[model samples]
Target: MSDPAPVSTIVFDVNETLLDITTLEPLFERLFGDAAMLRAWFAELVLYSQAVTLSGKYTPFGELAGGILRMVGENNSVAITDADISELKSLIVSMPAYVDVKPALDRLRAAGFQLVTLTNSAPSPSPTPLEKAGIAGLFDRHFSVADVEKFKPHPDTYDMVAKAMGVEPSGLCMVACHVWDTIGAQSAGWQGALVTRPNNNALHAPNVPTPDFINSDLAALAGQIIDANTAAGKE
Candidate 1:
């Protein structure tokens, strides 16, 4: 039997995986009078993004997020204004990278892995969140599901990255905090690494493909990926 391909490129999911989304808490608190609404609105944002994709329609992530924010506000009897939606979008694009992200990504780069990002968030003009966080140079490219008009966990989204990068799916490793993202990449024939960020967990279900690596810390996960790929090459 032929040996499986070694993972030469690491594909990261941005947003909550690398960037800290909790930075929006103060805005949420000001708008809804409760910081916890941040999570509720974000959860809805993701859920509906996929729902829209499944329904054969497309809306940019930013637009969808804005609409969901208003929905959440209405559901909770809070009023969300146009300025509030604008502030939310601005905060999202300016979120800081988690402290562990830069160093861990640097480590992966030093190990000679091609690093890239696949996000549902639309590609904005310069000074994107990665640039604002000062880690944009660490990546070779940044991809968005926006290019394919679909939210992630959709097979075509992963395929777009693989095709654009000029590599077979097996040559890529998807690093994401959300199981749905990893599951999508794995289904597309890539290796999957799960970063167990807060509220994210490895799914345990029959016939589900578990991640090849799982860690709460990006640095630890980076090490595992590097070591595994190194050993695989040696064999």
Candidate 2:
């Protein structure tokens, strides 16, 4: 290809992409004796989030997360009580941001790029996760999949961002740690950057399209996006 479209807006994914999911690991460990239970429950949460979308039904993300925690606990023969579920959900809004997230967001902001967040988390009045992460001001707005009754990897979910920004999806760059999220955005004609966080990378499949940019973390990815925008005279 001769050239790629410049990204006028950058949309971030909240969970592990910006906020560190491990912040809630201790709760899982206390309840299940395995901190890895947090990861397992999260996997189920995403799976069910997609499963409901495919079934033409909707479930709020927090509800799905709490339900999945029970499923994961049951799989290990632990009887997860309602109190246990509540305990975990209560910690969600307070999860900490990744150490690199603020610096990355700050760089993008200083370079004249619009930055915002798109999270699968259902909206709540308890203050957005970014607020709890201490990076709320870094984003212009926080969009949730709950608004569209769809989860990520769905084409409509990606379209919502462009519609909200009043720009064609091609003018937006979706920065996410999950390849599936990036793939969905690209399929909807948006630019994409894969954050390639630990245990997270693009799938190596024949039909899987790669993201326009890939880096080990948001800090490096921000640098790459800044360079690309500069080279394209967007800076």
Candidate 3:
């Protein structure tokens, strides 16, 4: 029997996976008088992004994010000022990476994996969030859903990465903090590795495809990928 193909390309989801989103809490607290509104706004952003995609409509993720923030502010009876939106945008593009991200990415690269990113955020003329976070140079490529006009968990979003990399879906592994993202990548025939970041985890539903690797620590997840690839005779 032949060995199965090894996953040589690791595709990462940017926002919460690599960048520390908790840093935005202060902005949310200032805007809505509640730090918890950070999560609320993010959830709504994801929900509406997918909703519009499913409805055969398209809106740039950045614009949609700003819209969601305003919607949250209005719901809380707080006015979202232009300056507030500008600050939010600045903070987003300047969010720092989780401490574990760089080391794990370095380890994976050393293990001979091609590392790249797939983000729902649209392309920016300025330095990207990853670039601003000081890790963009480490990636071989960065993909945005803006090109596909769909938000993630949509199969097309995952498929676009495989197509762009010129590799079969089976040759890729998606490393993400979101279960929905892993499910989408897996459904597109890529292996899934879920980094169980705070407030993120594997959802074990009978109909859902559980991730192939799950760890709270990205370094541990990198080790697992390395070990598996080594065992499969990847050099």
Candidate 4:
């Protein structure tokens, strides 16, 4: 087999890789007060993401978020207003970071890796979930697909991030919990690391490529990146 590519910069996927999405469950339950409805809303959000991509229909991620919220409210017998959706969007901006994310980011920075975030989220009027996570300053830069009017699994989205960081695709490592995101990055010629979380199960999506490395935690993936860089004389 060929040698592993050297990693100069690491780009993280924001939602599940760095942020703890579980926090949203309780918040949503409290806001809507119906467990089943909240779950269905989240499920539909994922479904809509795929549907939009497959249908070649481009919608802002925030709009999709609002749509899911409206569907849930309607299902739960609550009439949601524009104001209610706006408040829910604000809550998303304040979602907490995962426990392991900050330290892992610190370690990567200490090891001389530039860090950044490439997310499918829209550029919004308020602070993003990254700002709420308190690690907003940790990243060298942040990119949203809204800038390109595309979403994850799209090659242009990955290219946008690589171009912004001034790095060739091969020199940047895309770290994400979702296989599709990693596959997209890898196919676009960037190295990818799969940060496995409980809900990510490597679904058998046709034409999706596997990631370069798979680890259960960010710290472990950070170590691998450091080692890879050192081996390639990049450290």
Overall lDDT per candidate, in order of appearance: 0.91, 0.86, 0.90, 0.80
lDDT of 3 by residue, 87-200 (tens): 888888889999999999999999889999999999997677887899999999999998989899898998888999999999999999999999999889999999999889
Query: lDDT per residue, candidate 2, 116-201, as tens digits?
Result: 88889888785767777789988888899989999998998888888888988878999999988988888898888999877798
- The Cα error of candidate 4 at residue 22, in Å, is 1.1
Q: Higher-TM-score candidate among 1 and 2?
A: 1
Best by lDDT: 1
lDDT of 4 by residue, 1-235 (tens): 1256677889999877888766667656666775445557766886787688777788988789899888877877778889878876766777788887888899999988899999888875546678767898999888998887778878889989888888988898889998878888888998878888866745456666667777898888788778777887853
TM-scores, one per candidate: 0.96, 0.95, 0.95, 0.85
Q: Please give the RMSD to the true structure for each candidate, in Å.
A: 2.1, 1.8, 2.4, 2.9
Which sections of candidate 3 miss by over 4 Å? 1-5
Candidate 1's displacement at residue 204, Å, is 0.3
Instruction: Name the candidate, 3 or 4, with the larger lDDT value.
Output: 3
Question: Which 10 consecutive positions of candidate 4 have the poorest summed lDDT?
Answer: 30-39
Cand. 2 TM to true fold: 0.95
Error of 4 at 57 (Å): 3.2
Q: Give stretches of model 1 more than 4 Å off.
A: 1-5
